[model samples]
Target: MGDAATPLADTRRWLERAVIGLNLCPFAKSVHVKGQVHYALSEAQDAQEVLEDFTRELEALVALPAPERDTTLLVIPRGMEDFLGFNDLVARAERIVRKRRLEGVIQVASFHPRFVFAGEAEDDVTNYSNRAPYPTLHLLREESMDRAVAAFPDAAAIYEVNMETLRRLGLEGWTALDVGPHA
Candidate 1:
């Protein structure tokens, strides 16, 4: 989906063409339109450095008000290419959230190029729902999430609906979007 030189550009396109365009995350479009999404690129060369960067970004998000920064996408364009390693990093990130006593205040959601759900096959089209052009940590405010969920009816079915959408889109349609790791 993106090379080292243009992770932010690629990420923005994925947000526009896939996440928002396909309605993968129903709440994304509003914040995006408001310019409340923060995109940060980290050049950390290892897991520890990535965690440090994550901590900084986490603090940064909390330091700001919700109207100014509703969410953050910490894009790691280096040293986190392996999905398993990236998954481990995500665990560490959650620990940081707890360590800072922000468990309910903020939450971490992960996305990776090779994101595979539990029991799902590596090539399953469903995995694409969480797949992104790069390893990313999505930091969200719990209050904002709660409000959004409250406003959207049948929010519990978003995942099932996304699966149906992707199933209909198929591999060719996803390829047409050109937003996956291989794009």
Candidate 2:
């Protein structure tokens, strides 16, 4: 929203400063450093168009080798401003993966500016773990995820660690990151 490059720039900052800096996802650093992550900007103005964009990104990701493109962040700068609507889009995305019979090969993860855990309060800092500057669909390869999980000694503990990290950081600390659109 800030500019033509705002979405991607802010996303990269969020990934580097929050995701990697906080060690939220232990596996992200490697692919990021190796430049295997793809950043796709969607010009869709509606859910239907967004889904179309999602399908294209999914196909593109699977078409390339893991070493070439391990993952993709389909950034939606228009439409999908509502979290609930974004959730619906995510469901549709999941169905797309299943329909293509790529359910086990690829996965769709959602991240939004207003991401909130089911039971958590909207203002909870922990929700920031999945929040992004704009609505985003994180397409990840199952094989890469499996390899990363296997390489990590305690992959299960990563979630707990992220929770503690965010709790300690608090909203104030999150705002300090300046990765969000408002920030």
- Of the candidates shown, which would achieve the greatest TM-score relative to the real structure? 2
Model 1 clashes, total count: 1
Candidate 2: tens digits of C-alpha lDDT, residues 1-183: 456677888889989999998898999999999999999999898999999999999999999999999999999988999999999999999999999999889989989999999999999999999998999999999999999999999999988999999999999999998887632
RMSD over all Cα atoms, model 1: 1.9
Identify the runs in model 1 with alpha carbons over 4 angstroms from their true place.
1-5, 181-183
Residue 157 CA displacement from its true place in model 2, Å: 1.3
Q: Quote the lDDT for 150 in model 2.
A: 94
- The CA lDDT of each predicted structure is 0.92, 0.93
Cα deviation at 176, candidate 1, in Å, is 0.5
Pairs of residues clashing in candidate 1:
1-181
Encode model 1's per-residue lDDT on 151-180: one tens digit a residue. 999899999999999999988998899885
Q: What is the lDDT of residue 84 in candidate 1?
A: 94
